[model samples]
Target: MSDSGPVLPWLVIRQDDNGNRYRVGRYATEDEAQKIADSLHARGRHEQLYVVERISQPAL
Candidate 1:
């Protein structure tokens, strides 16, 4: 199989109080993505959650 070009494995995901998840952004490194997640979390809005994840495939 051919490899996908310019893949970003790191992802920042946002989840709302209703359990709906969204992709906030993508990064080249986990640290970069986590930094964004941390900043969002620091907003102190308990109704939402931010998380970082490493994935194998490109987003659709």
Candidate 2:
């Protein structure tokens, strides 16, 4: 079997404010990331979930 693992998109869950009492899951794609954000927003937890910001990919 080939020793290969599927590339997993990195994610970072953090708060947006300095209080640092929220969570945000970053994703490789905006759609995927936004989905989480939207869910939080729908549940009236936008501030708690913060925003899904994507990190710049390093040069391969």
Candidate 3:
């Protein structure tokens, strides 16, 4: 037998580091994640940020 689950929405944030790419954070929604990114930008951590829509794999 096999187990499967539904897919859910996720917000992925990515940042650039001198041409190198890295993930900053992941959240349940874009709004929530953007808010965090805005805060980070205010603190001067990241100069460029983006929000991406994604779906995680099945839980089991």
Candidate 4:
């Protein structure tokens, strides 16, 4: 058998201040996920933004 496909990590985002959490999106590369996290962090402004960030892992 061949190797499994690339790992697509789940990228979830949440707003800390208002207790609002949700699944923003998923990425096949950590760099992609980080971009979004960075964007969200910048958009958070004064409020705290939370992220359930996970590493690039293969699907089980």
lDDT of 1 at 56: 84
Best by lDDT: 1
What is the C-alpha RMSD, rounded to one decimal, of candidate 3?
5.3
Candidate with top TM-score is: 1
Which pairs clash (backbone N, Cα, C closer than 3 Å) in model 4?
none
Which ranges in model 1 have alpha carbons more than 4 Å from their true place?
1-5, 58-60
* Ranking of all predicted structures according to TM-score, beginning with the best and ending with the worst: 1, 4, 3, 2
Q: What TM-score does candidate 2 get on C-alpha atoms?
A: 0.48
Candidate 4 wrong stretches, greater than 4 Å: 1-7, 50-52, 55-60
RMSD (Cα, Å) for all candidates, in order, is 4.1, 4.4, 5.3, 4.2
Q: Output the lDDT of residue 50, model 2.
A: 46
Local distance difference test scores for all models: 0.89, 0.55, 0.61, 0.69
**Which scores greater on lDDT, model 2 or model 4?**
4
Error in Å for residue 4 of model 3: 8.0
Q: Cα lDDT of model 1 overall?
A: 0.89
Task: TM-score each candidate.
Answer: 0.79, 0.48, 0.51, 0.56
Q: Residue-wise lDDT of candidate 3 within 1-60, one digit each (tens)?
A: 234343236655556666555567667666777787677667765556554656565565
Poorest stretch of ten by lDDT in candidate 3 = 1-10
For residues 7-35, what per-residue lDDT tens digits would candidate 2 score against the true structure?
Answer: 32545454644567444554656677677
**Tens digits of per-residue lDDT for model 1 on 1-60?**
236566688999999999999999989889999999999999848998999999887456
